[model samples]
Target chain A: MKTDRTPKIGFGIRKIILALVIPFIIVLIWLYATMYTSIPHGILPTIPEVGQTFVEMLKSGQMKEDILISISRVLKGYLISAVLGIFFGSLIGMYQPVKELLVPIITVIRQIPMIAWIPLIVLWCGIGETSKVVIIVLVAFFQILVNTQSGIESTPKGYIEVAKLYKLSRWKTFTKVYLPHAVPQILVGLRLGLGGSWMAVVAAELIAATSGIGYRMSSARSNMQSDVVIVCMIVVGIVGVLMDKGIGVIFAALTPWRKVENENRKEE
Target chain B: MKEAKDEIRENDNSYIINVEHLNKQFIVDKQPMEVLHDINLKIKKGEFITIVGHSGCGKSTLLKIMCGLVDYEDGIVERNGHAVVGPGPKCGMVFQDHRLLPWLKIKDNVGFGLKNLPKQEREEKVRKHLEMVGLKGFENSYPSQLSGGMSQRAAIARGLANNPTILLLDEPFGALDALTRIQMQKEILRIQEEEKTTMVMVTHDIDEAIYLGDRIVVMSARPGEIKEIIEVDKAESRKRSGAGFAAYKKRIYDYFFEDSDVEYDVEYVI
Candidate 1:
């Protein structure tokens, strides 16, 4: 009964309609530009041309292959970065010596752009899968690590003092106090790292890879198939949104206490 | 009250806690300043000792030292007949802020210090203490889900879950509103009676001190010296409107205003 009085924001079909308003306007603008303007088909594909190309790509299975290739690369790099980042982040965050030893070097290394490392990575590992994976790892690791580190480091001293009072071992303290406190923040890092890995893999493919959606886009660009390039861009955007939402759902499940806190704030 | 306290002392010469020449210093603005100076006190078993003082009076520091949460270089601070090197199961502490982990459910937070216990026993203890604190239905709730008084009740449950011989409270109810604080005070006395645990509470509220303490340790700030220790008979001091309560309040106010020209006693003319 106490929860009944709170004014709820729309999350029904109305909310979905509200969300789609901008996209609908964007499509309308695209339709108007393509139909009325004298812009060349190579520069900007007409609406019907884009729709036909999207249908053609869907029938050929080339689109599926390209999307699958890009997705798989993103997954591989994201998993590696998550594991290593959390491990080393926990270490560096917990221990002063580890932080002192790693942070300075990591800080300098993180400043180096992902694209700038492409030439060197491709030179060492060639324009193959290894270089792409390496590129994604280089891009994603710092995002995950830095976020995880700050999250772990920001655990309140009060909680640590409670852990100490209980006589918990270092590992126990980390697991019970620091880890739980940092879970939401770590998820934020993971989400950011996922986005970074996706971007990095695509960038790698554009520069050197013979596969993926990025490669498909670049190839389409070379052939002046602007409609196919637009299709690839749309797919990438949709996939990015899906990945973000998927992680968001998972993160929500992981920290149910946060939901409780929000409800408690309403009670207040 | 003096005769009763003396009788208890005679019955048990072994004090539960003994603090001798306790001196504590903290570096404030790059200068070593004394916070507690040559403090000495002895606490008997199952005694409720309330410390009343101004803010920054080192009463909290003194309580922390007794709990073995803080170290002292030059003083002897003993708990359960041993030197307080660090926090142990013999002593538990409740802070001003209810220091429950926000992520933990009430059950988990209360049972936090009971990690070494078997699972069933820990759950039983957690359940028992939660009921004792009147938070039985809130076992699954997070700390943030509870109101301020409820959070404090959970914190007290956490403190008592260890089954410590002594519980040290550093203004545990200071953050609560007036009505809730009074309610919690009554509940604390009931819990203390049931548990028979020795408690040392540092508070600024004189009424709370007088109502709860078997003996009140009045303290002055700056050097953080113990001004006086007044024994209270529960029957009289517990009655807030009674003459005995006013007498105790006046005595405490006089001690606070002794060196100053401020006439704390006021006559209201209507």
Candidate 2:
């Protein structure tokens, strides 16, 4: 009799294959459609043309410079936003008076779109990297702030009561009990905020940038170089995926309980 | 009991806790809701005492008061001849829920109350406690990964890791299913035998009280107070099928069922 399967192939690898299958099929269809169909070449850039364009951009060194500039701005903006968001969010979450005072203000500010802030940001910081960074920071800060506040507020009463029972120092309570309880929610907020900031940064750069990927896209649009624009868009998408994956990895590492549960479920 | 107190006073170091006329009340919507009223109890060193009552009998509140988690309206709780102020390293509590920090490993959760100890010493203490609790191999497992019984074991291990003078357990077995609860009880008995630490556990389950406790304090509901404290001398002889166990269970059940509002009190004991 043949031996049963070892079950050692791993579900994660299978999941990756499952995820890629449809996308790969779609790309194949696109290539075949380009080869056989009468659709205008201008409207549907062939797969190889897009690939060639991607390689060209990589060789020019222009893509690297643009990517670096965009990334640097995003880093600064995201860092500032993360610090401010956690600080204010915790403040509002902790004290009732502060929450009452600030909740309405935050609710109002959260409603305003990042694009709407463009004119005001331009007026205040001028149409430089500063304004783009400001836009990114503003977009990210509110999302994280709101999320952090909610996270802190939603911690179980049991945990806090336990902490109090132990007479844990205030700092220890915050670091050990409250922070750990609120981490998953805070991370969700951060992930959402990261995506929001990326979108806002690109928009801000497109409208007023002299350098970066957004600047390249704008310049490409002006010259009617749709291929370059598409290339830039793909880069943006790839970077977004990578950044999200990076955050996800960190989140999984931080919460091993979740990882174990997921692994168990997959086995089941 | 009076003579036992006199002997304890003569050798003050033997008694771990002395409670005198303890009372606690809460103001709920301007009404003075009394919880524990005119309570007096004493816990000897290296003894296991269980408090059994209905849900509203304030057994948990009494445990909290003893641990200094809540303030009493009147009376005094003394530990080692010193009036209780707040919770100290000498008293560790296990709640109905495990309350293990989800982010921490089993070892870290067990070691949480040992923040003041040196790192190596804390690790050793944690490992020793885990081994005693029969969770030696699962030190890195998270609370979420463990079964309900396992989690409670971890919580028990955490309580012991501090090397506390007393372990205050409030319905620690309540969350487990029947088989698991029985297994946990056996494990706790083994640990109690090994550690020889004082334990005061609160439960609504009479058979559990009889099985695990040297003395079971039966409590009355609403403005809660101790009705009677029964000493189970032949606890090992009082098995589930034994006549002694049945008699004690019936007595406690009849006392609670006297109110008529609690219909299943007798059924719960069986």
Candidate 3:
């Protein structure tokens, strides 16, 4: 079985480079077109202008303040939703009565997008931090809830039977068997929730925020400073990727067994 | 012959598990479907009993019922004279798929049932059982890192680590390749002899039933019932190809296919 399929270090590096090649080409095209074309700077800023604005924002400390505020809001909202979602999701998944009573209501509520509730939420919470956080929570809650419930539900019956045979206590079974089985799915939900939180926070900021990456973009748009808008967009995209990669690292740590399977698939 | 076996069981106080008039039914498509009927079995202490039958014969259900993983509407299942109400530590079960937790290391998987024990004692038992199952060095490995046979071995170790009075196996080797299945058969036999643990296993393989079981319980399908119980009446080192073994296989085959029109293809080039 130990054949030529073992991936070489150089090969892996080449694959990484190959993945970046297309993005590199796209950026190159954007730079060439903006620099060479007759398009106005107000409509489409050059790459150097966006880069200059990014550095200036970083040095001025205004960008840092906005990023910190947005991150704190996202964290507050995401953490609340994650805790509540997993807690209630596990209960609904494990108990039939809870599921029957709440699933229909949850399904109906999930159908209403987070943005749709912004008006009502702002009216209730008065366009404050509370309203923004609530919006982010609504966005993050459904994905985590659904994924956590499905993860718990889809735990292999065989493992449950083994737990039964050993006469494991309910708590023991949940922690040792069900929780471990659901980790991968739960992580997936968290990643998705994180993404939703970013989107929701940005939308909330665009509508009413005093300071955030989204608010910065909104102000720049009205002021026709496209360089600042582009800079904010780049920051948002990079931050989202970084957050996702952070979750990926945690997931790999929790599920080392899956890493081996993934490597085998790569070999195949 | 059945009466004689019952008499022997009545005379001895060594029976660890007893089932009488066990009946089970399932609701399928809003219709009641009987799965097991009038199933009677007695497994003595330290005895190895293998129940063999066709698919849908309710043999696996029977094992589940014994392990208290399934409930039967009517029947008396007694473990050491006490009625089985639910799953308890007295019975450990091994499933067809080596259901070792993928997130747990082999040692942790084996020690799963020993949660009530002290950490040191549980670790000792886990190590001993892992060594017995020929998985000494693979303790730290995850189930995904192990091969199918190795994972199954870890599962058996987990079953045995609990030190249950009886171990119930549901087609434990059914998923293995032929050679690994044979090896696992020998491994189980050795474990059974060493531990002297009572074992009741369900299998579809007739040869495996004869090879490992002290008494082979043949079940019939379509509302499964015990058709016959044949005592191997041979030493532990009995030969598979010997005439005595062939005679037992013939008897079981006759009990299963005697009334059916199934033709046997005995001629082979090799």
Question: Which candidate leads the pack in TM-score?
Answer: 1
After superposing candidate 2 on the true structure, give the runs of residues whose Cα lies further than 4 Å from its correct spot.
A1-52, A265-268, B1-15, B29-31, B235-237, B259-270
Q: Which is the winner by DockQ between candidate 2 and candidate 3?
A: 3
For candidate 3, write residues B1-270 as lDDT tens digits.
658666767753667898999999999999998999998888898899999999899999999888788987798888887888888887888989989988888999999888668888999999999999999999888888888899989999999897888999999999999999999999999999999999998999888998999999999998999999888875631677776777777778887777753442241111
Give candidate 1's TM-score: 0.94
Pairs that clash in candidate 1: none
Candidate 2 lDDT over residue span B1-270, tens digit each: 658756865775677888899988988999989888888888888889999999988999999888888877589898767888888888989999999887789998898888777889988999999988889999888777888888899999888887888999999999899999988888888888888889999999888998888888999988899999887755543487777877777778777777673575546455
Stretch of 10 with least lDDT, candidate 2 chain A: A1-10
* Tens digits of per-residue lDDT for model 1, B1-270: 678767867653468999999999999999999999989899999999999999999999999889877789988888867888998987888988999999889999999998668899999999999999999999999998888999999999999998998999999999999999999999999999999999999999988999999999999998999999998878899998788888888888877777653455551110
The fraction of reference A/B contacts recovered in model 2 reads 0.59
| Per-model TM values vs. the true structure | 0.94, 0.87, 0.93
For model 1, give the TM-score of chain B.
Answer: 0.94
Q: Model 1, DockQ value?
A: 0.70
**What lDDT tens digits, residue by residue, belong to model 3 across residues A1-268?**
3336456666789889999999999899988889789889998888888889999999999899888889899999999999988988888878899999999999999999788899899889976789888998898988998899999999999888878877778888898888878878888899999999998998899888788889999999999999998889888998889889998898798788788767766666
**Worst 10-residue stretch by lDDT in candidate 1 chain A?**
A1-10
